[model samples]
Target: MQQYRNKLLGKGCCGTSYTQVTEELQELIFNHVNREHDRVNEHRGSETNPEELQELIFNHVKKDISQSEENRGNLRMTSGSRALEKHKLPSFKNLIDLIIDDTVFNNNFLQMMGGMTSLQSIEIFSSDISVNNTLFDQGICKMLHLQHLEIWANGLMGTLPWCLANLTSLQVLDISYNDFMGNISLSPLKMLTSVQELRLSDNHFHILVSLEPFFNHSKLKNFYGPLPIQPHMSLKELDISINSFHGHIPTEFGAYLPMLQTLNISRNALNGSIPSLFGDMKSLVFLDLSNNLLTRGIPEYLATDCTLLQFLVLSNNSLQGQIFLTNFNLKNFLYLQLDGNHFLRKMPDSLSNYSLEGLYISDDHLVGTLPRWLGNKSCLIDIIMSKSHLEGPIPLGFCQLESLEVLDFSENNIIGSLPSCFPPSSIKQVHLSKNKLQGQLSDGLSNISSLTTLDIGYNHFESNIPDWIDMLSNLTCLILSNNDFQGEMSIRLRKLSQLRLIDLSHNKLFGHIPPCLNITIVTTAFDFVFDSHLVRIIPLREEESVEFTTKTISYSYRGRLLAYMYGIDLSNNKLVGVIPYQIGNLVGIHSLNLSHNNLTRPIPLTFSNLKQIESLDLSYNNLNRKIHSQLVEL
Candidate 1:
């Protein structure tokens, strides 16, 4: 056998052959393992009493095994094991708490455990949970250790268990988003000195009770959601939205929630001006009283005091009067939606200082020119002042606002040509219709490649249509109508393939109508000729006879002729030529007045085509031949 020492030192092997080294190594391994085992056993023996240690380990394992067995039994019971017999159940005398959040409402379990003296917390949150008088009647008052309880979203019916008032140890209670419908009295919660959070939102609680208890509860920090009207509450966050709460905003609201950081009283019929005391709530960060009848001007004191506010929405209210920005110190405002108010007049000048990213003042009767100070708000992305009474030219300063994306001043009194300096790269729509403006269309307008709709109609403008208008590739609606303009229609107009409307009427323009105009989406009422005047009458020539044809004739002779075709009044002109026979081709003609023109011959027989003629006037023409039968009526 070879003896091998565990130590790392150079030493001669103790009487062992190399062939037997393998067996030696195995023996050494066995010996080392045995030694380590012995050492561990010795350490364990010195540290703890063996019997006590064994007992502790056995108890832990046993407890785990028992708990597993108990869980198995509970699973069996839940799985509809043989109906639990009341006598088979163990006594619940030591039960200190019970919480059930499932479909299993064990009636026998409740009956057996209701009398437990140490039962403290009773929390049942389930869709099937039902609350009745029987729970209280069955000795629920015995709960002594109950410090906090919450039963939410349960389909519980009937009044809250009256015995809840007897739970002196309760510190918190939440029975919200449930089907409970009844008068809620705070008397039961008055004794809960240790309560910190109470939530009863979305419940059918309609009665008003004394709130003095909640007001005095020093530890209460959150009393939120739907709540019955009470004098006051010691809350840091309160929400009474979506309720039938009416009457003016309670002036003491801020006083009661001195530490409140959020307060939402929206969706209520709350009326009257905002209470000035709201300015005292220094801790408030979010205040939403929207969707109410709150009237009068927003309190300047509150706006200045709530400098830390991030969201202050008072929309859909009767709030009126100018927003006095000088008094407001809004440094952290992110969203301010004051839309749907009947507030008239200009926005406060101090609005230029607001750092609002999203602002909506739509549907307000805001009047006067759009404030140029708006350009100072460099952070504004969306500004909707639609349906307002804003008038005058769009401020040129708006072109400087590079951050503006949605700028809507539609349905307003905005007049004048769109600013030539308007940023061509950013503007999307320029709607300036139904106003009193007079100017040639801006040649620089073609620079706005982003333009989608340009409506500047119903104005008095005298200028040729800009040829550059065809450059707007994105243009969709082009409404230029009811104005004073002249010149031949532009051939370039045919290039506006995206045009949806084009109206040009009631102007002085002459020359052949552009043939390309037939392709345009245009609706016009144009008079091709002006009223005629009188010229000197001339003698008839024996060699030339009166001629009529379908075509209009220009006379070289200085006299007027009276022949019926289409009615004509070329009464005064230097036009000279024999009336061609084509004039009589106008069979639909009703009247004729070539009366004050140059010399002409006897009336042609082709006048028989004037069957529809109603009036004739050859009075001032030079004619010596016998009158024809067509002239008998004259």
Candidate 2:
């Protein structure tokens, strides 16, 4: 077998390659030439172009060039190099950077790459194979010259193998999203005196407390996870967002890490009142104390002194008392998420010329009408006020929000007809479920051809299912359940092939189960989640969610896993006729509920094709011989 080796560069020239007397080995490799990566902007930052077709390696690197379906010339670090022999290649060492991106290869090359002493950067992104423990113990630990190492989202499991004590030359280390479990300590990481940026987010590591270990190493700049309270002068961004951090947030945070521009201590077990000293950190840009056990009111200084603060997320906390006081500056504030709190306020009032973009204060016991000041927020994109006690009609002034995309007033006491002028043209998801709103939905949602989710369920809206409903070509979810609606299943729903979840259940309707309801959005990648439409975040924003009752319980589905959930709930309605055989065409469906409807026919045997079905509810229907034997197998 021919061996693949790295061809290192020396100060703008080709440094060395092994050809004359090296061992004959066969391995897929990226042949990067000196000063040529800039020509291909697609591979601009990477040291080697990942899409190596049949490109020939430099003179001393390789004589024979080959290509195949699996490798694609990616550097595969499989274990046990070819049997050593003379006159072939001695010990080829000069692999500088190894970037294994979306390539089918085992991660056993670490120890092998250790021979290539010149290896500096190793990035393995979007990997599919299991990374074994020898990855650190044999390969990376020996590379004292390696500087940047990133193994993001590669599905690596188990506790971190922290043999990285001698790499003093390392500057950047990112092992985020690896799902590595750990009571991992950063005490060993402090040895890398030259490290600047360390990202440990989305891992399962319970890291060390107190930024005390790195307090002495003056160059650390961006730290992602593992929260500790300590003073580090040069540290600009300190993140302790995902961990088992307990106890109260020390009030001296402002004095400690005085240069911190962004602080994220969310998703922890810490409880206490908001620290008053945070306002003293004059350079603060983003502050996320959300998803904590934090309680009590906001400190006055945080509203007045933290002038540079733009994004504030205190969601899922027990924070109470009045919110968004007049002292709160609105100049640079972009997104404010105070959801899951008990703030006893109606809405933020002392705002006139605000530039807020996304305002989410759901479940805050907010009462009264949505303030008229809301009309001035021209930059508004998401307005979430679900599960509140807001009353009266949606203000006519809401039409002024020309940039509105998500208007979720779900689970509120808001009544009165939706004004024909409401639902601006830019709306994508208008969830007015669980309200007393009454109106012909068509009169309001007529012009919105771009709407994707129209959930007006659990309201008093009454009208025939309009033909224009099918005109919503991009509709992914159409939930009109538990509403007063009389219509035949006459609309052409099959035209909405992009539909993933449909719930017209518990309403007044009569017709055959639309064979077209089985119009499958199923594809090879139907499970892929769409890109989050919320532009700015606490690095946070709500994604689309749908509530469907299945197996006698309502479940709300959202986020990444929700992508694979295909459900159709047409139960509890006045419907009649044979269950269409084509309904079984929804082979990708996970939940199919057709109970509580007045129909008569044998259960379709074609349902046996629903291999992905998780819940099949066909109760209370007048139908059927025994269930299909194949479906019983499911």
Candidate 3:
């Protein structure tokens, strides 16, 4: 292979024959030139000296040399040009950047790089060749002094090669995810107009390309797809998302791109509305129109002209009225998703006018009340307004948010209590389950200590199960189910060593039950090597949800499969005795409720090791004997 890439660039071995190759292609050309000189001396720049510029950009680009696997079982790429006419191939004048990835491109390997006219960047990817598309105009667009071209995911099918308009000093044209279909004619890319990063995405085109020929390009900055064009007011990232593009959203694209910054036309079939000239795009920053079919509402000029807007996604659109936080100015907003809209009222006490950090107005059937100026939003962190029929209380100025962390007011009608001034150190998930929230439980919630999900289930919470909730040592879901909670369930709840769900079901609790509640939390098999600490203690709540009442309905476990939901629901409580043989040590429980408890079961044969039981209720309780035949194969 070109005298083993010119003897790994110390050029010697010129007249050939260092035993003419194959010591596994000379140890894959000296381990890809010492792994590209240790990846360009690991990004040099300590005032330069990457082994004196790693032989000028590591011999000017060539990746995975000879893609080895023992020379692909006897050099096959149609093993034609008479098996590379007995070696000695590589000569590309003085390579100016050539990357041949996932190798194998035939026609004698494109006639040995068609004598690279001092090539100026040519990337070739071969998805196992699948040859015959007329060998890309006799090999790599006849290299008219090419200027960066990437042939990606190379299963390149027909069309799209009208000699790439003679390469007109091309400036990066990435043929993306290729299988290119027919008729993509903008008159052969209109004399290339100095194409600036145009990636024809996942091809299967039929585009006639008239976005006024990309406004006669003067450096189109990043344009993907031939779909519904418009890019090129010196574009700055415009992703024509999942195409089949329908109407609206082209009111001269914010008066002509103006260095637009990231606009994704999400999953299209896009219908009207949502274009108050996209609030006059003042260098807009990330605006994704989610799953379209959009309608009105949401146009106080996008918070009064996108002032450096940071991530505003109009979620699953249908978008009706009312988001008048005094015609927004967004103050550098950070993630404001108007979730599945139909919006009418509520949520606008000028929404503390932005210092936001993730606020998704969920299932918008929004009604009045929730605006206690949202307790002065101190850079709020995650407030997903669920089921949106928002009602009273919760605003003891939300203890000034103090960098709040995920508070989802579920199925709202939110009544009083639960704002006894909390901010006890960055709260972690407090989903007000099916709200009608009545009091108790707040001795400043044991000062929060980074709580992991405290769901106030089926509302009206009356006191006691509180021993300051065992100081929440990172609790993993402690849902106060159908409340009216009466005393005695605390054995300091085994100090919650990262609990995996515990629901005080239909409470009025009478003693027993907490036999170290099986000391929950168990995921190991090296817990997938702590996948970023289990995605930040189970966060990946896609469109938020968290209700899991077994057998008596309520499933809903949103995201990351709610971290593999392990469970415990002290069903219909008035709990008396027995049942807890350490609750079968919980063996990674999957729902096990002590049904209508006056519990006197001869049950526990350690419940036959639960083997991750899927719902076992032990009905009405006081069982007089028999049945523990290892719980009869569960």
- Candidate 1, lDDT over the whole model: 0.55
Per-residue lDDT of model 1, residues 432-549, tens digit only: 5446666777666777767755655456666777778778876644545446656655667657655433334334333332334221221222123311111111111111111221
lDDT per residue as tens, model 2, 216-299? 567889887676666777788877776778888888878787777888888888899988888778788888899999999888
Q: What is the alpha-carbon lDDT for the whole of candidate 3?
A: 0.67
Model 1 worst lDDT window (10 residues)? 54-63
Provide TM-scores for the models. Answer: 0.45, 0.79, 0.34
RMSD of each: 30.1, 8.7, 19.9
lDDT of each: 0.55, 0.71, 0.67
Winning candidate number (TM-score)? 2
Candidates by lDDT, descending order: 2, 3, 1
lDDT of 2: 0.71
Pairs in clash, predicted candidate 3: none
